[model samples]
Target: MLEDFERGRVSAFFRRVADSIPVSDRPASLVITHLLAERPKFLEGVARLSDVAAVLPKPRSIDEGALRQVKAAMQVDELNRDRFADPEQATAYVESRAAGRSLGLLDVGGYFAPALEHLHTHFSGRILGVVEDTENGHQRYEELDKLHVPVFSVARSPLKDPEDYLVGQSVVFSTEALVRSRDDILNGRPACVIGYGKIGRSVAAMLHAKHVGVTVYDTDHVRRVQAMSQGFRTAATLSEALAGAGFVVCATGNFALREDDFARVANGAYIASVTSSDDELELSALNSMYARTPTEPHVVRYSRTGHYFYILADGNAVNFIHGASVGPFILLVQAEILAALALLASGQYGPGMWEVPAEVRQSIAATWLTYFHGVS
Candidate 1:
């Protein structure tokens, strides 16, 4: 099934051949440009169409729900290099580029862009203009000369204002979506959280902050040690952690849990995944034994990222999937995404595989809501 998926999905050719392409005059657009709002790597089966042809990759933020569908459909793997291996160093690199410059702000839609613009405009410091649109072209701007926009790293956090905004509507949206999925684990009073990687660790921290038990679990002993040092349980194996756990959140990048793994899990052991790859956890195995759509129903989804089931958006990056509310932070995310797009196309970030920017994911969600869902 996995190989067929790889062949049927990932291996499909994307570029239109000369024989396949309809003849046209005036330099026909052989380039099939795709504006992706969610993580592009998840949609695995179209490169053949663009192979040997120009592929202009544009990023847009999309609905978290849609993001998951895209990932499952793509059958992606984590072969791409992580851009932020040393997050601090990556962030510092961005800062270095803008030593004494102001980050130029561009508001593409009525979401994060506006909030960020509002901050730059009304806040104490000098801020560049807030555009109603960026469709019209501009060679460059003055604000990017300043270092306001942190557009270089994996911006997964929320916007911070002078007064508490609850992360505001956006933060509320994220928390509620996450809570709904793992509510059972909370009810069970989990013994520990089995998180996969940095993202899983982040969620574990969030759960820990709420006094919920969190345990770092992955094939990586280093991650386990890191979690233990943080003063949490460290289990060498899945059984050790699941022995008394109320729930589990799998963030590991692999989805190879066979039927036996599920059997070992305690009955009604709640679980969720927040990784970029949706295939990491054996959702199919869990579905065979436990809840179904009839038994469980999806409540309102928060901005497409936060919904039930330890919410995961398009199996891309969890933070991006869960983040759909108005976060001024997304503004920087958009910029970094634009930077990434630039890198991919211009060969600055030579590519085999890569993820679309979180901001683009949100934007694409909104766009699809309009194009496919008939909403504006």
Candidate 2:
């Protein structure tokens, strides 16, 4: 991109941040921003970081034992409890990503309202919503489950308010339950978990083991039972659980990181969206406010054979971001991106499995290089 800039192949970076236009297309100037982000795709096409990608071929999946060792090595407990506990960093991140439009989370699960709320307020007023995601998530909405589960999209009643029906959306990935449940058993600030489904349960158990305090508010009886059986106190009300949380972790399928929810939280609680969607993360308030505007353009690569994870916006999803994701998560995301990039670069970015450029693999590797910068 620098070369492109020097050769004038790309336009200068630009984007209208005013609230009037919510979803703006990526202008040519976006090329400059992507270059500045040095995202994998941008770096591959630019300075040719092919070796870095090659250096990181496909990674193998790991078992539970391997995961525990890595987590211990990373000192996740200390980080979660002391340094990175508050949503301030997460809010800052959202503010930068959202840039001025005020973030709006469509929370399918309202487990982490406190964290989400903090984001909206931190962004100077974004509107977020708590869209229930389970039959038990809301009293009035559980009946929607009877609607035919179309082979395609989830059933939607055009004539109904989600609060009036029970088809609560489900979120796929969330580490909140795990982290918060772990935090629940211990003594410190609480971490909120949004979704209480399968992954949510697993997260809760992980949290219990970690000895972290948790306060859950799910409509799912099974979830409540499971948590109670595990000795974790459950919250009967959303408002109660969100009273003074400092971190928000959402796993609900529908967007749980609503901007409006930010109102309930203090100025510091962190909001980490574990759901899968650029919609939740692509346009965050943090990004809009603090994201460097096409300043020193350079690719930011991150790869470490060991733990010390380089989370992408505090892991918007377990697959693309978390280090302890199921299987070789990073490799999976990298491989898919690589194959797609190869197709796109070759003008064959169609809907079939493809190969990733060696350079892209190498670019990911460079992200892991440890630099002391005179401190050492």
Candidate 3:
């Protein structure tokens, strides 16, 4: 049921990365966690690999049809995060599947990073390294006091630049679609983007392109300077950014908007997130402080002090509500992730954070350019 273009790209990626490693050094078993809704073809490709022990579906977003298709094609176990009441239970479930195996992890959004200490404590040297897919996850690994295994990140890789740009386009596309459905337009609205990372930069640029008065706020002074240099307005503080913003997009992939910051949002404004709710906004605090009303599907109104604001997708990533499809280009990042796992399986790296090797990045980029754009 997959498209030929997607299937071909994924196969070519696997073959290219597989050719670089001796068969003996490849991972014997793996546990992967990812957003099942975004790229089913890639997920299915990975699941069909020889040694996938289990698949953990990120509870936030999933496509049942894709999940079923992948399950029918393989005999591997499926673990749903929503099934567990606690992280420990999930970790225990993973441990159960990993019994008597040397396990590798392909993680997205740092789902398994917190459990690394526990996994390392129990599995010890039997655990291979982790391949993280997002900058949010990479930050989680960086915050750890000790890393039990090497973490190869494609988050900041040059290869991911295309995906990040597309992600920004998707965010704006979804936001405008939602707004248009309500008979509103983003043009001429005062917009604030609360992050200056790669995705944030793209979002700001897209908003500017749409004629929205976009102002950027970044915790990093360097990024703020960059934003100003790029001709977008800069806000030194969160309150200043939200002062009169009619549209707010949190792309920080961290807790960028907290309860205290809510009061500053302009009344009737639409607030959306680019990452998970927990990473971009303090949902728990907002739920407790404001009176929440379901304005419609994927839209909630939070009101207090006679002022109210709309939260898209109940504060979840707005783009996913509209399928968040960035198309076949995402395979580039997936290829880099596969290469990272291969490197980790080789036992050449020790416990610490590592970048996807230069050779791997170069190889993936070359393949992507040749296959997608007819570039040499």
Candidate 4:
């Protein structure tokens, strides 16, 4: 019943955002993304309303159909996948790419803040704007709030309401995966969720709904209080959270978990990452501690302590792992991306980091409700 309601709400919300995009033809855009097959279709559709000069591919091991389509449309600045691992190279590449182009930047990870800063420093006038689609990226962009370039983000969209519904659906997908992995049903097992952000809160809610005992830990007192208000256990320290938890979900985007965390975890506790970044689980530190690499898909058994903990998607985004069925949620965000680019091209918005305008947001919600979901 909850899922049904969320689906209707998200679809309606997405349609309204789509409606807010000006009907006038949009200008050329440069899209930098972690290429996914579905993403290209949406990008291509949006381009018909606007011109796109290039689609820069960030290397993730996805099948190449969508990537080929993107290449067919325009030049693909093929950066080596290794560049993403090094901040210096990645930032440098972005600066080089953005040099002297007044094109709109449709950015995925939002790691291009340095490049944006560089463009500002060099006085190349201004690009159309920047659009970011990830929480980590949005947070990074907020740090540069003083920049003159017009910045917009779907990752920070009010429609998805990251703190509640959107994160709620994502956690539902992940919990389903976590439960299916075990032969025994997960009911009543203690689960520790780090970070009381949107993702963490949703994860805890779902786990608790499934009759799993949940403990939440966050550095912020307010978040901890929020967790407590929901009637879940609250941990004062990391050690306390991991002490007896049979399942641990690291939703914090920051590097919070480590060898010390593993040592503190219950011997057989499963540690999974809900955040997209590899550093969320600190796999490199874990690998250094282990003599051999994890051979199985998304499963890592430590060599030193012979401690076994399964990593969903090899510590990548557990929700987006193969067959998670969260594509609908991703599409909702994609719709906002298209609208964001259209807004940027319309020249209606000005320089400065800002939220997606409320009118645009409402338009998206109205479109989805009326046309897509038949909510009229």
Best-fitting candidate, scored by lDDT: 3
lDDT tens digits by residue: candidate 4, 161-278: 5334555556556655555665534665688989888767878888877788989999889999999999989999999988888878887777668757766767656667765545
For each candidate in turn, the TM-score is 0.42, 0.33, 0.92, 0.81
TM-score, structure 1 vs. true: 0.42
Candidate 2, residues 222-241, lDDT tens digits: the string is: 77777677676777755666
Query: Candidate 3 lDDT, tens digit per residue, 1-376?
Result: 4577756766766666556554464454554554444455565445433377666666566677767766775444555435332457656766676665667788777767767777777653377878898999899888989997999988998988988998998999999888777888898689999999999999999999888899899999999999999999999889999998999999999888887888889999999899888788987887667899987677788998889999998788888877777776787888777777777777889999999778878887787787778898
Q: How many clashing residue pairs, candidate 4? A: 9
Better of 2 and 3 by TM-score: 3
Screening candidate 4 with a backbone cut-off below 3 angstroms (N, C-alpha, C), the clashing residue pairs are 12-368, 12-369, 15-364, 15-368, 16-363, 16-364, 16-365, 16-368, 17-364
Question: Candidate 4's C-alpha lDDT?
Answer: 0.66
Decreasing lDDT order of the candidates: 3, 4, 1, 2
Model 2 spans with C-alpha error above 4 angstroms: 1-187, 277-315, 322-324, 328-376
lDDT of 2: 0.34
- lDDT, candidate 4, at 52: 66
Candidate 2: worst 10 consecutive residues by lDDT?
27-36
